[model samples]
Target: MTDAYYDFSPLYRSAVGFDRMARLLEAAQRNGQENGWPPYNIESTGESTYQIEVAVAGFKADELSIEARENQLTVAGRKAANDAGDSTERTFLHRGLAERDFERRFQLADYVVVKGADLANGLLTIDLARELPEALKPRQIEINQPKPTLEGKSAKSNKAA
Candidate 1:
């Protein structure tokens, strides 16, 4: 990570536990490059559901692959070796379409899993949902009410006398 971002070095020396934050900062710096090839979109479908749409124009289903691991999602497309063919055999005067291979990575939140992916009409859409374990989900705890003590009941009887 850059030194301008809080000078994370002191976090390791002066702080007791901020290593995870420092590591995350480093990862962010590595992924901060502005490579705009193959545009994409992220939208919220539900309270805990999300969808990512990436333009895979010239890529086929077989040429693309998606994998999620350690809170990171990677989508890569590799064209076949013989797809373009020999220049002598096939030549293009104007090749505007980006048939070149590319890979995109996204940082996912905790408990976020890639449910499914579909390639349709040159668009690759990936569905994700946050599935928290039952232990982590909020639940109503039943608080037991204490029964009336015998001492309190005897005191009430004495007061009545």
Candidate 2:
């Protein structure tokens, strides 16, 4: 039988010591696939800003979490009892709403960071900003004037003197 191996080290090369860690996490994700949970979108807010909106109908602000460590953004959700003693048992004719717990991760760029998160009208919006490093920015080099050549004037006079 042939051996099956998966390598995912390239995804987290920008982060320190996270290459191997990401590889393990990716392997685990492939091995144990969970239920397909929520609907989301990633929008380019501007040149340096991005926003991720998830449709979390039943989840509240406390039930969801947005985490950014190294070069990865993870969105997780947990179902908890409502404050007004709501029922955990959801009955649906078509059964489309996602009430199960889930964790979704996205690989971010080198300078990308999460700004904040907001929940409104059954939507959770997470904002991200990309901050480039000073050294990585473009810098213009100054062109200096060329020095004068002495060969045009001094050779014959200095030898005769």
Candidate 3:
């Protein structure tokens, strides 16, 4: 696969604290042509909440794993190899379903965290939430009125001498 280069110099020059976003965009463009396997979906469940659902047919709970570290979420699955002595020798005419191993990763934004995960009916759902720090959360700033000057008059006062 060919790696494509993009010029984000303009964005870097004009934007502040957006370096992570630019890096994510570049990484996505580079991997845009990769194979799609073990399809997944990301949905917003509520304010500051999200869910990721992945289809993992034919895979037992023991064969799958999910991990969250720093700002990355990774999901991996592997089916145990069948022992030669356990199964009768049988030839398959056609194999359509994919039971192969797969690994998928997602980049999470700042303050985003994985709350929990569950698997039901062959679907693996991962819950997430964004919890911003108190300092980062928006707050109303009080606009203080100007105090009276030394001349015994307020800045906004229009009393005639």
Question: TM-score winner among the candidates?
Answer: 1
lDDT of 1: 0.86
Better of 1 and 2 by TM-score: 1
Error of 1 at 125 (Å): 0.5
Q: Estimate the overall C-alpha local distance difference test score of candidate 2.
A: 0.80
lDDT of 2 at 91: 65
What candidate 1 gets wrong by more than 4 Å, as runs, is 1-23, 83-88, 149-161
Q: How many times do residue backbones clash in model 1?
A: 0
- Per-residue CA lDDT of candidate 1, range 11-112, in tens? 677767777677677667656764777899999999999999999998889999998877889899999877455666657899899888998888899999
lDDT of 3 by residue, 95-156 (tens): 87798999888889889999999999999999999999999999999999976567856645
Candidate 2 ranges beyond 4 A from true positions? 1-34, 82-95, 146-161
lDDT of 2 at 135: 96
lDDT per residue for candidate 2 within 74-133, as digits (tens), equals 898898845577657666789777677878777787899999999999999999999989
lDDT of model 1, residue 82: 73
Residue 81 of model 1 has an lDDT of: 79
TM values, all candidates: 0.75, 0.66, 0.69
RMSD of 2: 6.7
Q: Which whole-number lDDT from 0 to 100 does residue 74 have in model 3?
A: 86
